[model samples]
Target: MNLAEKIDKILANEVPFLEVAIYYLDFTVYFANLLFPLFLFLSVIWFTSKLANNTEIIAFLSSGVSYYRFLRPYMIGATIVCIGAFFLGMYLAPIASQGFNDFTYKHLKKGKKAYENTNVYRQLNENQYLYVGYFNVTEKTGTNFTLEEFDGPKMVNKISANRIQFNEADSTYTLFKYKERRVGEFGDELISEAKRDTIFDFDLDDLTPVKYIAETLNLNELNDFIAREKEKGSSYISRYEVVRYKRWSLPVSAYILTIIAVAVSSVKRRGGMGVNLAIGIAIGMVFIFFDKIFGTLAEQSDFSPFIATWAPNMVFAVLAIYLLRNAKR
Candidate 1:
């Protein structure tokens, strides 16, 4: 459905076939990797429901196989999936995400800003701090800029400007209405100018990350990126941390969802496979619901990302335990 829509869009836009093919490949891989575990859960339910209907599960337990023993193979399989999912999400999905998002923005959503960070603040180092009221990534400019330097809590110098623009060609800044104050033993010396060009301790591109930048980096790169963003007092730190934590949580969810599927479908019911399938679908939707709700809360508010990332799994784990116990009986 999405492919068809994108195809129509690209055709109307006259986007090239090569770009479309690349987008299609990356688009398919990214979402498939993301939803692989959920699909695996339904597959498990289908297979187990069939086994139960055929009386194979009953025979295994009736012939002195412990329920735990019957579940051993499933657990082993889940472990393999867990590891595979971890590597794919950590290493490969980011590349696919980069391709997918890059194409989306460049062609599908051209001229639109992903988002802008306002009232941005950064601790350049122990001694230097910076602030900007608003920044433009494309223009490489900011308004109401301030940079302050201190030595052991005592102020050294402060610079303020009405507008600042980065000169990428020469690696300097052009400040409008520039003013500087230098704190000295005798007194503070003020320097004022209408316009000035100078260099700073930072680069504009380094200070401001591009949108969807977090989704394009591998694990190590992401960790380092988050550390820098934290020091910079980024308002979207929660969003970045959510992505990082989900990298770890995705694999763990593979096992949790698999166990739930087995427990839910390992018994024959009056309505047969369809009943188990309907139940499985409901459970999957509920899992997605909790995941999205908590994830949004963390991203949009001060909610803890850790709890948001894992809470759904924790809730479903308890449910899995309850269902497994019942199935055992």
Candidate 2:
């Protein structure tokens, strides 16, 4: 459906074909990063269940192979998959995530509904602060913008504009209906102008930035971004922290899911492979549900991002251990 919608847009010339193709590639990478662990779990369950059904597992056991010895190959396979997933989360997926979101906002949606942070408040530095009531990224404009400068908790100067626009050609900001107030030792000096062009220390990108911008950065970049956001006391820092912790959590989940899948499918039963697959799918869905719930909590509430990211893995790891113990008998 997503592809079809993009294709329709392409046919209507609403979006460029090359852009859609690039978005499609990026989307594929992002989806693979999310689903590969689940797919590997299912694959292990299917393959091992087949072996069990064919009596191959029984034959091996009868030939004096311990269950622990039998698990060595599966653990080795999981280790390989875990390493791949780590690379995807740490490096490749971030690049794809950046491209995917960029295309979605810039071309596919045309920046119609892309601004999540409509009213932005940020302390640019110890002395400078910025506020924007509304920011239109497509037009590179902000409405009801105000910037204040302070010196040791004392307000020094303030600039207010009805509208501010970013000029790409000259890389400057043009403030319309601008007003400025400067605090003097004697009194306050006020100035008003119809329009003013001034260069600010910040750019349009600093205004109402995307919440998931951290997801687009590699590990090193993400760490730096989080640090910067923390220094600025950004409310969205939790969202960034969630993404950072999730990179490690996702790779660890592969081993947990693998153990659960193997334990649930190691025994041959009346319904054969389908039963195992059904159970595996159900578990996968539940795991996803837990992950999403905790992730949202971290993003929207004051939940600890580290705990939110790893909660599902921790819960399921215990389940995997219990199931593995039962299966060993």
Candidate 3:
């Protein structure tokens, strides 16, 4: 079997039914996301072409109706679509993403050497970090692990365990068959061994770094995640932050695209829908490319994430307004 087929077999064998449902839900959401914007772009072109072909646009203009007035209904329709997109991105997405990640970790590649010698690590708080040499969420435990709390330049507390169990019931971590060392300001270290459960007030979700790898997270989760990562001063957090904000900002781009598509395609042409669809898709791609490019630049430079994320939308919206006004003239 190939790599993906092998991975699918492992997931099917280990993950729970509910978890699988969430994964499929996430897949659905991603599929919807990929198509919705293109559909909106096409709708704009189609409607505009219909108006032109039916001679309704010409009749409206002759009867003292301006292009601005003609676009009123279309704008309202686009606004409603944008609102739906907003709700999807800001609310339903987070829970679905969390469930999907849980399934992937617990079910996919369970008990298999999926990532050999790869210890997934994450900083939980300032000077506090968790490391898992091998994790199997199905077992709710990780082996060859370390949880450390630092004081300035010195390690103040350290927990070295053979396995750390996730207390999903309490949403915390319990170190099992573990030994812990505590060092004070004077460097006198105290060590203790525990065979039973040792509970620490650390959120296991934070330590499971792969949770962010899922593409379906909503704005709230993304915002909270970025803030948490930023506080820990983790490397590559800025890039994720840019992505988080971009998700929210990018959806409203549909409205701007709608206007531009309407403006460009409203004029009657002998070239027909083929020409209009081509131009609309081309312009739509340019906007998308610019949006992505600016987001990358935001991560690499001093530009604010919000500005970089919204810049393309702002630029396109303004251009649409200008073209729209000219269309009336």
With a 3 Å backbone cut-off (N, CA, C), the pairs that clash in candidate 1 are none
Q: Model 1: runs farther than 4 Å from truth?
A: none
Give per-residue CA lDDT, model 1, range 56-143, as digits (tens): 9999999998999999999899898888888888999999999998888777886776545477777877788888888887788889
Residue-by-residue lDDT tens digits, candidate 3, 121-205? 7777778887778777456677888888997788888888887778767666666667778887566675656755656766554
Give each model's whole-structure lDDT: 0.88, 0.88, 0.72
Clash count per candidate: 0, 0, 0
Best by TM-score: 2
C-alpha lDDT of residue 101 in model 3? 52
What's the best-to-worst order under TM-score?
2, 1, 3
After TM-score superposition, the amount by which residue 306's alpha carbon in candidate 1 deviates from its true location, in angstroms, is: 1.7
Look at candidate 1 and tell me the lDDT of residue 201.
76
Cα lDDT tens digits, model 2, 79-117, are 998898899989999999989887776666653675555
